[model samples]
Target: MGLSVENSVTQSHTRTHKTFLITNYMLLGAASACIFLTLSLRLLPSLCGFFLILLHVVTIASAVSGCSIVTSGSNKSYAAHMVAMVLTSIFQGSVSVLILTRTSDFLGYLKSYVREEEGETILKLAGGLCVAVFCLEWVVLGLAFVLRYYAFVEGQSAHPRNERVSEEELKNWPWPFQV
Candidate 1:
């Protein structure tokens, strides 16, 4: 019975890990697409354009780092991943909303070399990709949390530290703290 339970847990963990990986991959693709769309606007000389591209690059880096950190299984790595994902998710959502709602104004700010209509079209496409990236970032964050929890549980079960305390060891504790 115990073996079966352990096996089931392992299977579940495996499935969750796979899902986490797939979501991160999707995020990478979406970010890349956003970069390409931004490039299509031919606004690389503009500060706004540079920052937009930088944002997508950061998103891609976060996703890549997330994939690498899974194997390290360190609390610090998990915290970093969570922080990166949250920030990127927020930024991506904001960018998408801005592009979708104020396409003309944003294009003017970008100083895109393309014609107005074409620039708007590209911005909308990038905005759609940003939305996809935003959603995928959150999903990745959730999956990372789940994977961390599973790792913690498995670690505890595999090498439990809750051994029975000896009588002498227990007696050394302060009265109120005695187990």
Candidate 2:
């Protein structure tokens, strides 16, 4: 009886914590997405550029809540993840190509910051570094989404449980939450 009560309490606490964590992730993702979109649109201010930036927002959304990507409320979703990756990659690729096409103008814009030759070199280096970092972040976000989707499809999901898991299952649960 004591064990049953403890399990019930633990399950409830776990459910509440899961909800809170997910909510925090979603809120932060939405806020950061707004910042990213605003900066991209303001800096580039072109139709294709806007869409490319919007894809970045979608990528963040996927990381925050891949489960929410479902259209029909189903958990099985490897195909959805594939679609997301393809679409995001297309936009990222297009943005890179577009940057290439604007090489002269981009350089001019960079040089505008500081008119010295050294300034131009610095600008080029900084811009390249920023792009590389952004691409790395995008890759990480994609990997996280893929991992989350895989867990969902395999029923190894991060769902908030209404009922207590068996002791065997509890053994597999993450540490600090082990019952």
Candidate 3:
């Protein structure tokens, strides 16, 4: 049997964890939709970019909440979620670093293509917004992994391992792998 935290431990953390995932996925879906809106509504690409970054800010905040929740030991599924977050954290961290490293290159690229009078301003504003969000996203996702590790270790030590696998149950699976 796995470690079990007493119900008295409080479930606020699990509630918050679920809330973050729900909000993150919903806002991310909307952001994906907004990106498509740029194809048809052509007042300004920069305006669309700004809103896109705003939506992402919400998503990243949700990620931070998820990270915090992982540290609280409120949910059993935290391990699974953190396992997934590890992959996303790596990807997001790389993206954030790339943006930071290439910010100047990005501004130059913008100057080369965007001839609008305010292109540089938009570049600074919108790119700064995106880079900031990416940076925060990287931080939280990495923290989530660390938090999950501690929770896992703490949980393992807290609960009693009373349940044992029966011979019949063991025989049902391949010898080396039993649930």
- Best model number under TM-score: 1
Clashes of 2: 0
TM-score of 2: 0.37
Where does model 1 exceed 4 Å of error?
A: 165-179
Query: Each candidate's TM vs. the true structure?
Result: 0.89, 0.37, 0.39
Question: Which digits, one per residue and each the tens of the lDDT, describe model 3 over residues 94-160?
Answer: 4345445665554443233444434444444443444444444455455465546656755785675
Q: Which residue ranges in model 2 land beyond 4 Å of their true spot?
A: 1-45, 67-76, 105-179
Question: 71-115, model 1: which lDDT tens digit per residue?
Answer: 464778778878988998899999999999999999999999899
lDDT score for residue 18 of model 2: 56
RMSD of each: 4.0, 12.5, 9.5
Q: Give the lDDT of residue 15 in candidate 3.
A: 52
lDDT of predicted model 1: 0.90
Instruction: Give per-residue lDDT, candidate 2, residue 179.
Output: 42
Q: Which residue pairs in model 1 clash with each other?
A: none
Which candidate model has the greater TM-score, 2 or 3? 3
lDDT of all the models against the reference?
Answer: 0.90, 0.49, 0.48
